[model samples]
Target: MYQYDAYDQQLVDERVAQFRDQTRRFLAGELPEDEFRALRLRNGLYVQRFAPMLRVAIPYGLIAAKQMRMLAHIARRYDKGYGHFTTRQNIQYNWPKLEEVPDILADLASVQMHAIQTSGNCIRNVTSDHLAGVARDELLDPRPYCELTRQWSTFHPEFNWLPRKFKIAFSASQSDRAAVRVHDIGVQIVRNETGELGYRIYVGGGLGRMPMIGPLIKPFLPELDLLSYLEAVLRVYNRLGRRDNIHRARIKILVKDIKPEKFAELVEAEWAQLREGELKLRHADIEAMRQRFDQFTYDPAAAQDRSYAKHLEQDSAFASFAKRNVLAHRVDGYAVLFVSLKSPSGVPGDISAEQMEVVADLAERYSFGEVRATHDQNLVLADVQHKDLYTVWKTLREHELATPNIGLLTDMICCPGLDFCSLANASSISVAQDINDRFDALDHLHDIGELKLKMSGCMNGCGHHTVGHIGILGVDKHGEEWYQVTLGGSAGNDASLGDRTGPSFSRADIAEAVERIIDVYLEARDSEEESFLACYRRIGMAPFKARLYAEEAVEAA
Candidate 1:
């Protein structure tokens, strides 16, 4: 995690003071409700269905134990005793008083965290693989790039107010867990044949009412030109992106209207204006920023221990947890453990204050006091040692954090849809609960394999339904909740948007619909090794669509 430098510190401090003044004026009736609402939202404050919601930025999804404890304290002292971790790798508090939000901002600033750039028509949080520094397949640590971009984008004079909210994601890993394809700017970093690390930039990628996979504008962008290239991309989008209609204000709409080729050419032209000496990406700056992310350190000599194997074999429950929760680490003897908030019969990405405190404690005790939030809505203790796996699993299970379902169908990516979000047309949390309860068998979920069942409340695609292997989007038909399905979408190395299957189904019929799709996938698969995505890709949607729309699939049969 990048410790806040003096400039960063001063910037947040100033914003906190500014927000305090705004809070005073709003409470004093000096500012109108509408104006205050807009201003508050820009500061990550929202008036929710039942209360105010405040979103706090977790830069690149990295957090120190101290910061996590601060969040827990806030949840305990001010709002409800829990917070919702979002799919964008941020945390949201569902209940914060309007007048007290500034104090909350000040509290966040006390720990070097803030809620700035969290909402409203600006470049939002820059997210990357939560496993950025620890993942085995990573080419380069993208936290430095993400931090550099965050500094450049935060409060930029030109790009501050855009047609709509913009998002960017970066990945240095060979396998894309960050879902980079669905962001406005998806950056994939790679080393050249000669071993020079650079980025393969993807532009105009986004999911919402209109979803599209980003196009490769620069097949290989030298790291030195990373900032300049991004500047050029933003310049083009800000200049030409639609602003006349709120519904069609995203860069994806502009990209689709202009076609990807022309958009690429426009970015290229903009890049030609500001390349080389014209920009400011010196090696010293990169090194200075990179040093900030160099705080994490761990041991690498626990894998060969006889005690580790003995511990695993002794406890069957611990063994099950080790198999499901622990992940491969670049450092031998170390493992990355994913703590799933999406437990059976629970909210998808929520943690109570006690739960937060426990995770903070576990991070300090067993995982070096570092915790990360995944884009898939899970918490990660990135550097646990193999010898500590049993102890860690036991503690997590005691706290209800050990769910033994990392990448299963039950580990769903969901948004706070109509049940909570004012923008949603249908409920998401309820639907997710339905699916989880319906597919409670761990073996069946694990056996079905690699199924991403993403859901969004509506067409805004907050839940990223456009890219799920089996996407489900909630819709409202004559005041009733229904779901629209999409098939064959993926977000890894090869990205593709899902295609619509057929008509929407009632909320009561959705779990069955999903099961029918899974049933078809299970029957059509060549073997158990052929996962849902492979089967969907190999067979396409025709067969799945036939099964989904068939009357047999709609009924219990």
Candidate 2:
């Protein structure tokens, strides 16, 4: 994790003081609602349907154990007893009072965390691979670059107030776990023939009403020109991106209208001027940023422990947990463990204060005092030793965090829907619960195999439904709740938007429709090893579409 220096501390403290005064003025009637709206949004506060929601940034999804404790404390003291982890790897409080926001910000600042740039039509949080430094296939550790980008863009006057919200993601692994293709700007760290490290930059990728897989703009960008190139892309979009209609304001719209080739040309022209300017990164600068992060000390003989194997052989429950929740690490002795928040009994991504506290304690005891939040709405202990696997699993199970459903159907990505979001057309949490109840059997979920089910309350695509193997979008049909389903979408290296089924289903039929879709998949698959995504890709949408709509067609006849 990157520790804050004096200057960083001063900047946050000063912003907290300023916001505190601003909040006070708004309540006192000195500040207008319209004016306060912008100020509060910059601080990541949103007035939801029922109450105020506060989104706190977990930069590149990394949080220290102490920071996790602070989050647990905030959840307990300020709002409801639980908080929701989002698809962007941030956390949200649904019931924070308006008057107490400044106090929350202050509490966050004490732990070197804040809600800055979490909302508004500005550059939002910069995200990267959750398995960045620890993944076995990673070509480079992207956290240093991510941190550098975060520092540069925090309050950059030129790019802060864009036409719409801007997102950037980085991935260094062979597998694109960061979903870089769906971001406004996606950077893939790669190596060329000469073994020189650089970036493969993609632009115009986004989801919403118009979903797109960002096209490759610059095939190979030099290591030293990272920031300069990014500035060029932003400059192009900031100048020509639409400002008339909110629907057409995103950079993706501009890229689409002008064509990707022309967008690339403009970026190149802009880069020709700024490539060697102040934004050009030097070797020393990169090294300094890398040095700021704390390095872990691995136990050399951790892999030699026999108790982990013994436990796996003796306990079926522990074995199942180890099989599903544990991941291979780049280091020989260490392992990455996922603490699932997707139990059938609760909302996806929602964790209680006590659960957060327990996770923090576990991180400190077993995983080098640090925890990571994943884009899939799960928490990670990235450096857990193999020797400590059983004890960690037992503790997590006791706290209701050890659900062995990492990439299963029940482990879905969902948004706060009509329950919390004012922009939602229908409820998503309840639908997720319905589907979970329908597919409660662990054997059934395991049989389905690696199905990424994502649901969003509306077209904002906050839940990333556009990229799920099975995507569910809540729709309002004549004041009634309905759902539209899509199939074969993915957020991996071979990214693609899903194709929609013929018609929307009533809330009552949505879960059954999902079940029918899975039934079709299981019957059509060549073997059990074939994943839902792979079978869907091979068989296409015709079979699933036919199965989903056949009953409706028959009833009409």
Candidate 3:
């Protein structure tokens, strides 16, 4: 809902022009492959297994209806009629031609969007709670701060090329929907005892080779010093983070090696110099940034709808959809609807151009022309009136967007694994599809209840496998694709890395293994309310491990 001003427009236009020239040179053989690699990566273009993949950043996961339409247009014109939404709340085109990427970037620039910093050593997209302003239990809107951080880090001279890529996430709600704990920097908006707004800062949290839940570096940092404190933290990492080995280059590795206390000390020492610097966020600038976001206008008469209640009573399918897909909104008589991309047979996050246009139309008609992308790779219509919920559901169902499986096992977060990613050792999309097909029973999934299943093709943890209730990592074993499973991992406020199960399962047995793990959970759980993660935490890996290994032992015998 933040409109780009003339300055913002100018910056994006200039970058498009610059990248256009760079791309032309690279294609002309004037630029070396190594040099072009860095340039193209900075522009969010990756050469995949089959073709180039272009990742476009959706800052704070917010997109106007017009932007959505433009994205749909891009998909139709440039891509193969579809694009994939990613765990970072970005969109990706899997088969983009290198020569046409500049044209795509120009098209994106026209809509106040770009692929800049979506993939690079510089700070990536600044993500936040998808339900930022509209969540019923939100403490404060985190987007304003995310936007501020985006501006601060976009082309910051000191952090242009850090030792490794950086990510920052903000969550103001009690629920950690943004998975801030696994980010390079995690920001939690808080109010002090004196009722002044501030932040609880956590530094050096990340996944990949070393998964870590960032420690609380500063329990309370003043709101005015947000940027300065961030500068302090980044400065410490930028100077001290490892450059000798790419594997040990991330801030998390540095933090883990040096210890959180020492890292905190260093950050504090750096902050002491910048606490009063010009980088300090002033109230006036904050207010000006906040003004860019448009306030929603809710209808006073939309308190209740008898027809909606009737539909819920009569239609079991619609009832399930309404219950799972519709979330409570802060505004009275309104709801936030999750448009699930995880259809039973479809790819987890892939949306066709037609679906994009449908979502755009739905947003324009029902949600004030605004749409949001979630960290879980789903689209959200954040301002649907309760009265129109049934109509919205009908439209979504017609387009296969109403899956009614928001937090279920089928609603998984998966990466473009071996199918597209050249770096991948195994196929994440195939594994996800296999699991989805195996768990196609709606009643069974509902009975299993709120599960966060995540998968990655490799250890880069793009799908955030480290934090899923059920984490699956694809591995290469003797030229065969194998999967290693982990249990009890979570990305919430109480974040913890999952412990791996016994042995890797062959590609064929992976889905069955997942089913067995779920069966173990179902039988071991005290009640239906006990989720897979909670059950695993309560019983430990002994029971599940016994079940899986025993089955494997019997099969081997």
C-alpha lDDT of residue 172 in model 2: 96
Q: Least accurate stretch of 10 residues (summed lDDT) in model 1?
A: 548-557
Q: Estimate each model's TM-score.
A: 0.97, 0.99, 0.98
Error of 2 at 142 (Å): 0.3
Instruction: Compose the digit string of candidate 3's lDDT tens values, residues 1-557.
Output: 88899999999999999999998898899999999999899999998989999999999999999999999999999989999999899999998888999999999999899999988789999999999999988997989999999999998999999999999999999998998888999999999899999999988788887899998889999899999999999999999988999999999999999999999999999999999889987899999999999987789877765777888999999999988899888987888999999998789999999999999999999999999999899999999988888999999999999999999999999998999999998999888888988899999999999999999999998999998999999999889998888998989988999999867888888898889889999999999888888889999999988888786432311
- For model 1, the local distance difference test gives 0.87
Give per-residue lDDT, candidate 3, residue 338: 97
lDDT of 2: 0.93
RMSD of each: 1.8, 1.2, 1.2
Candidate 3 has what TM-score? Answer: 0.98
**Number of clashing residue pairs, candidate 3:** 0
Give model 1 RMSD, 1 decimal: 1.8
Highest-scoring model, lDDT: 2
Pull out the clashing pairs in model 3.
Answer: none
